[model samples]
Target: MGRAAAAEALTRVRKTLVSVPNLAKVMANSPALVKGWLALPGALSEGVIPAPVRERLAIATAQYNNCEYCLSAHTYIGAHVAEVDAEELERARDAESFDPHIAALLALSDAIARGRGRIDERQPKARRAAGVADAETAEVAGNLAPNLLADTDNEWPVVTPCTHN
Candidate 1:
């Protein structure tokens, strides 16, 4: 994509996700990565797992990996867009979700973040009992792609404090 088109794409993506999308300012430099970013959310959203579930998993993974930028971004998305509550957000930041279903997904997300996508046996069993399918679990893992990339980027360039405005 040309620079202008890429700029437009970034604007649209940021607008779709956040009003002042701070992370894109750094990430849009890589066009190839943008392509993957474009596809990931849609693919994950298409799965049977709810969008809020994906957000919870993403928040857990971000916090597990100590990515405060992702934690912040996903926290906003989770609360404003996904309608997740303050208690749930705190649970995610603490890596201790009380909701049984979310707790299971958080376990899978934690394992994936720590083990780099290699899940322990017990997590899947818990998810199974929660009626979450393997395919959905895989999608949850995939949904973390943007969070991981954003978190990595956060370590390099200084991302200033952004606002809802």
Candidate 2:
């Protein structure tokens, strides 16, 4: 897509998200990628995972990936938008939670983010034993993927050399 199409995509992103993030703006160079980025989170939000849990998972994924930008943004959003408490937010950084089910989810998130979506068989069994059903366990990746994307985009931004007039 050309620059105008990318601009239109970014406009759509801003309308849906209420504000355009820097990462979204950077990804807008490729209109298809920018538009596709919005779809995953929108679909995942409609799934079984709660918003707060997803925020926490984002925190965990950011931390595991060592993305300062994603970590900070998710931490703030987790606390403000999700109403996650300070202690819980800190715990999320380490993929821990007071709630076992959530902790299980966090552990799965860490595993997926750390392993790059290749978790061992025992991990799933452990998550299941901790009251995380197969579906929620599966959704952990759904929650983690966007955070990883943001993490990658922030750490190494897409560089397109400008052509001056």
Candidate 3:
């Protein structure tokens, strides 16, 4: 993609006004990556799982990897946009959740993070028992992958503001 096209795409899909320098760096290096990153969240947003639950999964994944950028950004999104409370935020950071399904999903997130896409069979059982679907479980796993990428790419503590434009 040309620089103008990439910038336009980013401007069109952005959810906030703050610009991330590293994101621009990525766009310059890999427009396809930027395109996919922008698209995945929207696709997952259409999934059955609630946005907050998904954000929780992202939070847990970020926290587990010690990615301060992803952790802080997702925390703000969870709190202001998704209404995730303080306790839940705390739990998510630790990869624990009170909601049974969320707990199961968090466990799955941990499994994916640690195992690199493979999860133990027992984890799926708990997730299903908590009313999570096989497809949704997979979605949670998929949702976390890009977040991990963004987290790994950005600098620690993520100086970038919550930028969209």
Show the lowest summed lDDT stretch of 10 residues, model 3: 156-165
After superposing candidate 2 on the true structure, give the runs of residues whose Cα lies further than 4 Å from its correct spot. Answer: 149-165
lDDT of 1: 0.69
| Cand. 2 TM to true fold | 0.87
Give the number of the best model, judged by TM-score: 2
User: How well does candidate 3 match the true structure in TM-score terms?
Assistant: 0.79
lDDT of 3 at 108: 78
- Best-matching candidate per lDDT: 2
Q: Pick the winner on lDDT between candidates 1 and 3.
A: 3
Write the residue-wise lDDT of candidate 1 on 1-165 in tens digits: 578866876876776665435566556777566667767887778777787877787777666666667777777778888998888876776455778777767777677777776877787777899876778777767776777544444432222322221
Write the number of the candidate with greater TM-score, choosing between 1 and 3. Answer: 3
Candidate 2 residue 48 C-alpha distance from true site, Å: 0.5
Off by over 4 Å in 3: 15-25, 150-165
TM-score for all models, in order of appearance: 0.78, 0.87, 0.79
